[model samples]
Target: MYRVLRGRVNSVGFLPDERLIPYLELAGFVSAALIQTFDLRYNLISALVERWRPETHTFHFPCGECTITLEDVALQLGLPIDGNVVTGVSLISRPATLCYELLGHSPSEGKFTGLRFSWLKANFEHLSSTANEREVMQAARSYIMHLIGGVLMPDANDSMVHLMYLPLLSNLHNTRSYSWGSAVLAMLYRELCRTTDPSTMDIGGCLILLQLWALYRMPFLASISHQSYIFPLIHR
Candidate 1:
């Protein structure tokens, strides 16, 4: 048996301010924000990884072969799977400028390519009651950045999100144009393949989706009692 690696379940710790809801909805992440956190089954994830075949991107079981589909991403996470592909420059030449343009504030003098989650919370967690529309929109962008870094597509560092995604969120209405669901699915698939190596010690990406996918497709592996079906299956 392969050793079970620790799954990184970085749940979004803070809820978006009320003013941010409309922007979140427009960005296609409102359903994702509604997902409640659950305990990650590390052993189950490890077992599944052991059976993963990177060549085909499917789990090989004694019964048959199966894989997480784009439809699963759409239903489970309530993200749009069809749209412009999620692509951007990973390196930011002017992080400060980008932050100021979208977030209305920039980190103090330092070489920074990413915005730390702590900094985002410290600066934008609380929107002033008398703030103008632009300030509210800026705060909303920070919240989505938090969601992306902490929950959706976090990497090994797990503390900051690259500024690349900030520019994409500049126009809230167009945020939904990118296939966020497909990007998430691709990240999860890549992580699953990487963790198949026995020496791997940590897992990243949305393990919640992976766990829920397993439970739904293989009922025998699930222990939760039946609940009323919800639009985004993650809620159940």
Candidate 2:
């Protein structure tokens, strides 16, 4: 599916075929927001980069300030882990935001990468009217991964995650033009946040993303919205 995208030039949101233009005219709002508050936004982004995995992608926060781990917070939210599903907590390792786990046999395979976009679209486009909370939590995690991974440099021998996904994702952001696809991307952004809890997704990681949303939000939602366009060819 990714093969069809015009990329870096003709489109902004990785939309397939007909959905070739960016949908958001509100970009002036986004740009204005960034210009007036560059320092604050930069600091928030730096704080987020400082927390990226630092060890593993299990959503562990090594920062000493937190009084609780995500597990404890989940318990407080009135949920417990049962298989991949949680009664109340959104697992940061599942593709739980866009309504489907990135659909891989094991956890590491779901790691977000530029190459995985087509697969991500294929898997998420068929989401049911109602969501599986567990899956949403997991998908939310992938979004976080991509966000942090944007600035994270992989170790010399480590291969599970790549650091190049977000830079490649920037091709869309750099190609801003008014299109229906951009509007759809904005909608997906709303849904991604609605499904993923901002206060608790990553021990305030989501909150950081909110503070730094201007930078990270596009890649997270536009990628999903891009994949969502796959249906015209397959289901048609």
In model 2, where is the ten-residue run with the lowest total lDDT?
4-13
Best by TM-score: 1
Candidate 1 structure quality by residue, lDDT tens digits, 1-236: 34757866556567777887888899898888777756777767767787889999998886778999999888888998989998888787777878888999998555577888888888987889998889988998988887787778878868788778898999989999999999999999999888877789988888888888888888766753232221123212
**Each prediction's whole-model lDDT (CA):** 0.81, 0.27
User: What ranges in model 2 sit over 4 Å off?
Assistant: 1-115, 150-236
TM-score, candidate number 1: 0.89
Output the lDDT of residue 30, model 2. 23
User: Model 1 segments beyond 4 Å from truth?
Assistant: 224-236
Please give, for residues 119-147, the per-residue lDDT of candidate 2 as tens digits: 33444334344646444433333332222
